[model samples]
Target: MSIVAIIEFDEAGVATGSRLGDAATPVLRVDDLGPTRGDGVFETASLVHGNVQALEAHLARFVQSAAMLELPRPDVEIWRDAVRAVAASLTSQGVTSGSIKFVLTRGVEGSGVPTGWVLGTASPDFTRERTDGIRVVLLDRGYRHDVPQTAPWLLAGAKTLSYAVNRAAQREAARRGADDVLFVSSDGYLLEGPTSSLLLRLGSRLVTPRVDLGILAGTTQADLFTWAESAGYATGYELLTPDDLESADAAWLVSSVRHVAPVRSVDGRHRAVDGELTGRLNAALDARTS
Candidate 1:
């Protein structure tokens, strides 16, 4: 429901059919405090064929993120059931495939209590691969947490809802005539793509930056790493530089939306795509999901 209806939760762990109203799923009570204040955290996960992929992993990050933001922890099982309920509603409404984004915010009192959240779905449409491939640009910006080492306490690993910064970085990348931006650390080590994980293939080694560099520990990258390690591709995570990226055998941006999209050109310089690694990684992903 795009409309945010009045939700009544009962003691038996049941949330009534949200009473219809003139509102959006994103709109909490205008009078309700949290929605207006932009205070809370959330997680988006892939829902396919009634199964939530990597759900445990997703919630782990969500909880950790919310805790860091000082948001109260809602009952995990209840939220899980709520998500299933919404997906079931969509199923009854005849939506078969796509992604679902779940957002849980701080309660109306502005206290840490969960005000409630909205679960929404998108078609997840993406353009087919262009043989010309994408061009990447390096922005001066790099992620630096107050505390390094990528510990959970700093919320460096949480999936927070504050994505405005990420969006702005994408705009900056586009302004520079690049398909994406690779965040470099203050010390000039590469971290990640704004909305994607940075991965490179050097012959047989699949190299990604260490999470300690203050990057979002991407689910897609983690899954791909698992396959790469098992298939003897020599998965590795190390600090890389702009020079390392520009001279890599091949590179791609990994995420839920694009899967594995190759970067053909960086700073207007063209590079060869790694068809073999892409095919192998894609095949592994398909096999796991299928």
Candidate 2:
């Protein structure tokens, strides 16, 4: 029944489903502002069929992202179980699907290393983004998926918690009036969406940015590729430029909660949102868990 003053965690026991709240005692959050500067790292995964989907992959990425920020690793196993336990609790209440987000902070630590972490849950409300499809605009920005020097080595590819820059990029797109923003480096390579990975359809190939090039390898995107290959689609990855995206057969902003959704427009230029492969991709993904 007890919770921490800082809301350190919103998790409970997996077997018993009891929330272990943060301590009532207050803890000074000196580094809270750092995250505002895109100084932290994070990872997320979905809960499905009463379990944490891709638990190992999520936990591994969480720590990997932390490493990118030069932050100390938390007890990842403990953190992993907390995610599972919370998802199980939700399942007990008839919630079949939801998303789990785990954020690691360098709070109160003088040297900017991770001092603690937090995780949160949201119910299966992914339909809102998926059903309507997402509007998007193209940034002259670039995709650094191949060159590490293209982005901050410390924060690149780690999925760090600090996402103000990413959020700002999204807002810039929204300012032009869109639901989401696709950020490409100024050099014209497709990095990713503000908060999701980029998935584009080219012929029969399912292509995304390679993880080495500063792209956060998306768990859901990987799942889609796995499904794609099994369904006779050739899944592939390469360093794609904005030129390629603008002319691609179809484009998508891929993420955990939204699964795979089509991009209706890009760079104030209108494109068709309705993609013939949308239903097929969704069906392939569904078959994975079903």
Runs of candidate 1 with Cα error greater than 4 angstroms are 1-27, 31-37, 91-96, 109-112, 127-132, 142-155
How do the residues 30-107 of candidate 2 rate in per-residue lDDT, one tens digit apiece? 455344455666666666666566667777887777666666665666676566655665666676666666655665
CA RMSD for every model? 4.0, 5.1
Residue 156's lDDT in candidate 1: 61
- In order, candidate lDDTs are 0.67, 0.65
> Mind giving the per-residue lDDT tens digits that candidate 1 earns over 63-175?
77767776655466656666666656655656654465666665556332345654546445444442335788877554453235544454565566666777898898889
Q: 162, model 2: CA deviation in Å?
A: 1.3
lDDT of 1: 0.67
